[model samples]
Target: MPTAVQALCANFPDLTPPATLALRLEALMPSRRLPAGRVLFAQGQSPSAFYLVEDGEIEARFAALDGRMSVLEHVRAPRLFGLAAFISGKPSRYEAAAVSDSRVRVIGAPAYRVLMDDWPGFARALMREFAERFEGNLRLLEAARHLSAAERFGVALRQLADERAGPSDAEGWQALRATQAELAQLAHLSRQTVNQLLRAAQAEGRLRLRYGGLDIRR
Candidate 1:
């Protein structure tokens, strides 16, 4: 079996750490398998461990009134989660859960700091990833401020379709495997508005509302 460092290196080939940092990571990181829908951490929880997704998807979300959820991010393999709290020395900003059965490497804050100190590449990679997330959040904030609900829904569907499309399926119809409520939360809209938007799109042949999700077509 691969050591923790080796597994991390394999997952993130471009962000290879030096020998000393690798040793430290191996000592500090432990792998865990999470079943689908497992809650990794919750909002307001004290920060202890950050995670690297070895396989599958993790969702970071905020719980709202009436039990609704607003998605913060969807993290895939080779990506890190819970870093915002780790860096800020605050409680977790959002709850994290396994979106599918997933393997994750749990790294404590101390080890993460060591890696950041000793591995320039690793630090750079983390910075880049976090920066992208920040930019995405900023865009979402801007969209919520200025865009109509319909426009936000359209943008959300197009983006989700692109992310799910395979190379062969590119330029063809695409499916979004999220419920209407989930899509509404992600797009910062209400379910009623989401339904209206979907109905309009379906009428125009731009998309079809399915039992669980949406099928978007060009």
Candidate 2:
């Protein structure tokens, strides 16, 4: 069986490092497994390590004053996160938690910077990943600002499906692993509104509620 680092390299073929570089990365970074619901970091905390998720789900969330938590993003495996605070040299604006049992490779900010400086390929890949995430966030903000509640939720469902879908069939139908509350939070809608939209989609054959989550059909 392949190691977590090896598996991550294989998963992101475009970002794979040469053997020597890969070995160096494995030596520099350490991997950990977290149980579901584990708080990886809290909002307003200072950054210590940036994580590259090797497996399972992770979410970034912001908690409102009334104790409501809104999800900012759902991250699947072979993805880097918890970097914005590290890059800005400031406290984190959101918290990260394990949505399921997860494995991740962690490197401190100083070491991460050293790796980027020493490996051009790694640096470029990291930069590209950051740029793509920034663009996605901007699009989400636009949808929230201009789209109707139902339309915004439609966008959220599609986005969740895309995130959870396998690489070979990303555009195909998939199940959502999130709860209705999570979905509502991400879409900026109330749970009652989310339920209404989901029921409407079900009537149209776009979604089906399963025991675990919603089964969506594209």
Candidate 3:
């Protein structure tokens, strides 16, 4: 293994003494970046790789027959996306897009299976990531089921707040890159409804938008 690859894999229990991180990565995964609003992959496309976010955000979205995209999941920094169809041998059921300029790790199927064969814990870790994403999606779905549009928006903020510890006093720079229209889809409401909710939240000091990004305060 190259020195850097060894260093990178030192903390990873599944890592092998491969040629290099870059070489093993060619087998394991490669990094990817996509522009804002561009689809990384579409529903029913070949599932080639599993993705883990290194930076920025990705929304796992689906477009209706009416041509509107609904967000099923929001993947933030240091999280994973693009694993569903990758593991299941199905075409992607949704589209993934950068909510902003983003970076992600793309693990090819061949290399991933190799890792799975050698590292039980690594395999379990991937499965665990999928479970977490699934449950998080369910929580949003449930919130939309019971909450009013405005309240659903509140719920989204609360969820994000919980993720970033908005309820705690650990405030810092954060970005909610979702546009109101996008938030509408996630909240299962109209853009106007989302705007109204956002306005309300802003008035109450729970959210504040800077020039390019929105910040949520608990």
TM-score of each: 0.75, 0.84, 0.72
Question: Candidate 3, 120: how far from true, in Å?
Answer: 5.8
lDDT string for model 3 (1-218, tens) is 12323322432436454333346555466667787887888888967887666667888888789987777867775566777687778898898888889877676766676567754466666676577657867778898788777678766665555444323335654555556665677678888878777788789877787664478643
User: 44-112 in candidate 1: lDDT tens per residue?
Assistant: 897688888888889889887787778876777666778878777888868999989998888897787
Query: Which should have the higher TM-score, number 2 or number 3?
Result: 2
Which stretches of candidate 3 lie above 4 Å from their native place? 1-23, 162-178, 205-210, 213-218
Q: In model 1, where do residues sit more than 4 Å from their true spots?
A: 1-13, 19-23, 65-67, 158-165, 168-181, 190-218
Evaluated at residue 137, the lDDT of candidate 3 is 74
Using lDDT as the measure, the top candidate is 2
Q: What's the CA RMSD for each of the models?
A: 3.7, 2.8, 4.8
Greater TM-score among 1 and 3 belongs to: 1
lDDT of 2 at 40: 92
Candidate 1 TM-score to native? 0.75
Best by TM-score: 2
State which candidate, 1 or 3, has the greater lDDT.
1
* Residue 90 accuracy (lDDT) in model 2: 89
